[model samples]
Target: MKLYDYPPAPNPRRVRIFLAEKGIEVPTEAVDLRQGAQLSEAFRRINPQCVVPYLVLDDGTGISESIAICRYFEALQPDPPLFGKTPLEQALVEMWSRRAEFEGLLAVADALRNSAPAFKNRALPGHDDYEQIPALVERGQRRTKRFFDVLEERLAHSTFLAGDFFSVADITAFVTVDFAGWIKLTLPETHINARRWYETVRARPSASA
Candidate 1:
């Protein structure tokens, strides 16, 4: 099995961190997003979605989306229980993971994609391109700040996004926190709980994966 990845991209990094946490190593081929490598006909045939963090199984079936790929690996090795050990834990992990993706990661993506010249007409990822909405930049920034606030509220009471144990929710939240840096957004100093949680997760060895 192989993973098509772009190392600098946030979504791919999510899968990388997940694999690291699971102690599973899959061979990877770098798809250069900056150079439009993912848009190539070769890559399009492999993944019609034309996105990075794609996994191709030994049977040649392709999996797109970071969480989906992570889920596949989780099914392969359930020891780490990144998704969750119990039904309630699984629901919480899914809830917070979606929150991280929508409230945090997508917010950052909106700002970056709409403001970066490199993105141009490619504001959204996938097969089709959408023109950037200049106004969304500020809106995205505002939403990202709100996401930080939301995280602060949640972390102030819980050790991790889901609960006591680190799970996929933490992975998504951790990646989103770092991705915010690309847009020059940061967790405010006053968000002590969120900042503390960030530092704790940042210290994990898998964070660098």
Candidate 2:
């Protein structure tokens, strides 16, 4: 079994951090996305979807998507329980993880993809080429700012997004917070709670993984 990764990408970083936190190491092959390596025929055969953070199991089962890959490891090693321990905690982690993806990560992605020259005809990821929407850039920026506000409020009341323990929710949110910086979007100084959460998560050794 091996993992396909592009270290600089946000999604792959999520999986790396997850694996590091779990203390599980998988053989990894880097697919350089910057040079359009993912579109190569060789990689397309491995992952038809043509995205990184993909895992190919020994039996040839391919798992794409960061959360799905993380889930595999969570099942493989249940200790430390990044997904969460109790049923309630699991549900909450799932909920907040989705929020981090949809509300936080996707928002920043939309803004970046729609406005950056590197993503010119690729507003969305995949095999198809789609033109960037100038209007969505503004809308995405607005949504991302709101995401910060939401996180600030949530962080103020809980030690982490899912509560007292660090879990997948925190990982997703932490990655989102960093990904936002690519588009030059950052947490305002006034959002102390969110900033505090960012600092705490950034300090983790797994964060560098």
Candidate 3:
């Protein structure tokens, strides 16, 4: 298996952290997304969709999305499991992870893509060029506040996102919240649960990778 990673990007970090936590190592190639290397013809050949955080399985299966890559790794390395141990746990983990991705990460991304001058005319990923809309950024900011409120409420009730144990849901939330700065958002003092969770996860060795 081969992993293509860009270190600073949260999506790739998700895979890297997962790999570190599982104590699994694979040959890797770093794709410089900042210089638009992922948009290059060669990288495009490797992944037609042209994205970092892509994993090429030993079976020649290429996984592009971060969650998909993490799930594949989870299947390959089951012990010390990160997803869940039971059917119900697995389902809830997926449920909360999806919500966090859609609500948290996507909100940050929308703000960046629409507001950042460097990302001008590129509102979506995957080589598409669209006109920037500043209004979208404003909307994303509002959505992020609402997202934090919801996440704080959920997290205040449990140690992790899904339940008592650390799972993929926590991973998704961890990365998304850390990326809040791209949208000029900050973790408020009132969000005690979220802040505590952030500190706890960041102290993990895997998170430092």
Off by over 4 Å in 2: none
lDDT of 1 at 102: 94
Give RMSD to native, each candidate.
Answer: 0.7, 0.8, 1.3
Query: What would the per-residue lDDT of candidate 3 be over residues 1-209, giving only the tens digit for each residue?
Result: 89999998889888888888889887889999888898898998899887888989789889889888888878877977888888988888989988888888888888888977777666877866678888888888888888888788988998988888888788878888888877778778999998888898989998877
Q: Which stretches of candidate 3 lie over 4 Å from their true place?
A: none
TM-score of each: 0.99, 0.98, 0.95
Candidate 3 — what's its lDDT? Answer: 0.85
Where does the lowest 10-residue lDDT sum fall in candidate 3?
120-129
Q: Candidate 1 lDDT, tens digit per residue, 1-209?
A: 99999999999999999999988889999999999988999999999999999999889999999999999888989978998888999999999999999999999999999999999999999889899999989999999999999999999999999999999889888889889999998999999999999999999999999
User: Which is the better candidate, 1 or 2, if ranked by lDDT?
Assistant: 1
* Full-model lDDT for every candidate: 0.94, 0.92, 0.85
Error of 3 at 172 (Å): 1.0
The residue-level lDDT of candidate 1 at 36 comes to: 92
